[model samples]
Target: MPSLQALKRSARYELIRAGLEGTALALNFGLPLTNPQRGVIFALHHVDPESPANWAPNAWLSITPTFLEQAIEVCKEEGLIPIALEDLPERLADPQDTRRYVCFTLDDGYRDNARFAAPVFQRHAVPYTIFITSGFVERTRSIWWKTAQDLVMRTDDVDLSTFGIDTRVNIEQRAERVALFDRLANAVNDAENEDTAIARLDSLAAAHGIDPLAITEHLTMNARELAELAADPLAHFGAHTLTHANLTKVDDKRLETEMVQSAARVGGYVGAKPTTFAYPYGYASAVGAREIAAARQAGFVAAVTTRPGLLSETSGKAATALPRVSLNGFYQRKRYVRALLSGLPFRLRQT
Candidate 1:
């Protein structure tokens, strides 16, 4: 039996799938007034040839390599050119250059990105970027999300009450696991002192026979691996903040260090200064005028957010904090990918 969360996700997926079908039909009919963007940038995460788990709670963070191949084909079929993230700001700046474009960017330097995603992009000759979070590559900070999932799934019951939850949580059933996963995620992200919260989780995982640091080392590509992947002409490397901290709550000095040093570290592997940035958790709250300003001050040519939408002339002006359409795990169909690029799903959201 599926958990309530799974059922909710299924219903939401169906709703968006129906919306995408409408978007595709409308796109075919040519509704330029509503869908005014000439191009889009795609946000992606894990791309692996194998399914990570049978009932993976974090499944949305991943996609199969086959889906990636189809994604490239779909963008080409739509008449959009595949470009690098570094070129986007320049393209966005030119009034005469109205050609539609698609840039692929995967965040946090995952191993699967090099193992599975790189081959497809190389085969298609598409220019793609990997935003490297230095701490993940060096195993200096916790890749808290992956660690949380592994700990909750492996242990039958978890006592996070010591971490400040009032009650001990059961993780035997899938539903129980989902609830605990969410609870733990909230505890960590929503905490006043996030580092303190993360330490508690590391301790919790250790108590339950899980190794948090090992999870980061295992999942992410190291400095040497990144250096090897950078040899591909089709590949570009960009900086994601060192610790993957929410940029908003951090101090100005810390923010600059996170942004600048992260890029410098990525540059060391790629043999050039990385000119792009992707904000950690790039949502409305995490990214704002301050973070955008910091990107420019850090010497980044552009920065991307997790905000959903297509790029237009008005939005392209603020190159530092640009929006991107997610190449979502739930809606991995080629038509859905086309629909996302068509700008119709986001258009429908306005009305």
Candidate 2:
């Protein structure tokens, strides 16, 4: 594990490079970098410090307020314009002009996005899209990460009933608990029923003498709050399904309902027909070429995944099924961003 100081330093460098300053001469360094593609969509999750360990494989890649500011400056300086997913069809028709543009999108509809991220975009006059999952919107529950963090921090013990792995945990057990957390979190993440997962969390908290409901309340956003954000021109809504289930594991009918219904419900509340879809736990194993094509079949213009890479004109129209680098907590190094954009640091997992 990287020390907090090491992580912060890494983050500072990424901010410098990807944020406006590094972009100025970044391409000249002969890394496999490309100018902002016709529609390079940025994917982000939570911005809340309270929710540190995100579901993304490496949460450190997430941008801080400082990094976000730099990113905004870089976008404007590089002449990378923003567009909504609804505008993609028309923009794609005029490829040359669109290739240099960028779009900002957030997944999971966390409150900090509206509370923190939106203002940054607004201050820069950039438009952004928020892909919301209805379960969290109506329920106002703590998201998975915050729930897990609360379990780890608030209690001196934890029990993993769902996985049949029960144990007591505390600060001294921080390293061990994080390892255990990852193990159980994966099972919880992979489970079809969030309730089953929650029950396990409840059992775990109970074992540790923590209140599960209190923990749940701290993680999610409510419908009313999402509605207010939808009112903003810069804020557009998209589908993240009713429940955050892995779409690939479900049958086609259920998948469509999850994909289409979530879009419709969020549309009704947000007052706009969403045209984009972001696959939950989007990756090669969780979703691939077929699932992405299905999202398009469901009337979406684009679908996004967690696969790390760039989207270029040469990348294909299925660029709708584009791979995005997760802006998470784990990615702190400026060199990492340089490597990612230059196409040198990370590679897609070959399944």
Q: In candidate 2, residue 302 scores what lDDT? A: 77
Index of the highest-TM-score prediction: 1
Winning model by lDDT: 1
Badly placed stretches (over 4 Å) of model 2 are 1-39, 48-62, 93-98, 140-142, 161-163, 167-171, 189-198, 206-216, 314-316, 332-351
- lDDT tens digits, residues 100-161, model 1? 88899999999999999999998999999999999988898988887789887898978776
Deviation in angstroms for 303 in model 2?
A: 1.3
| Residue 149 lDDT (model 2) | 59
TM-score for predicted model 2 compared with the true structure: 0.79
Candidate 1 vs. true structure, TM-score: 0.94
Candidate 1 — which residues are off by over 4 angstroms? 1-11, 25-34, 53-55
User: Model 2 residue 126 lDDT?
Assistant: 84
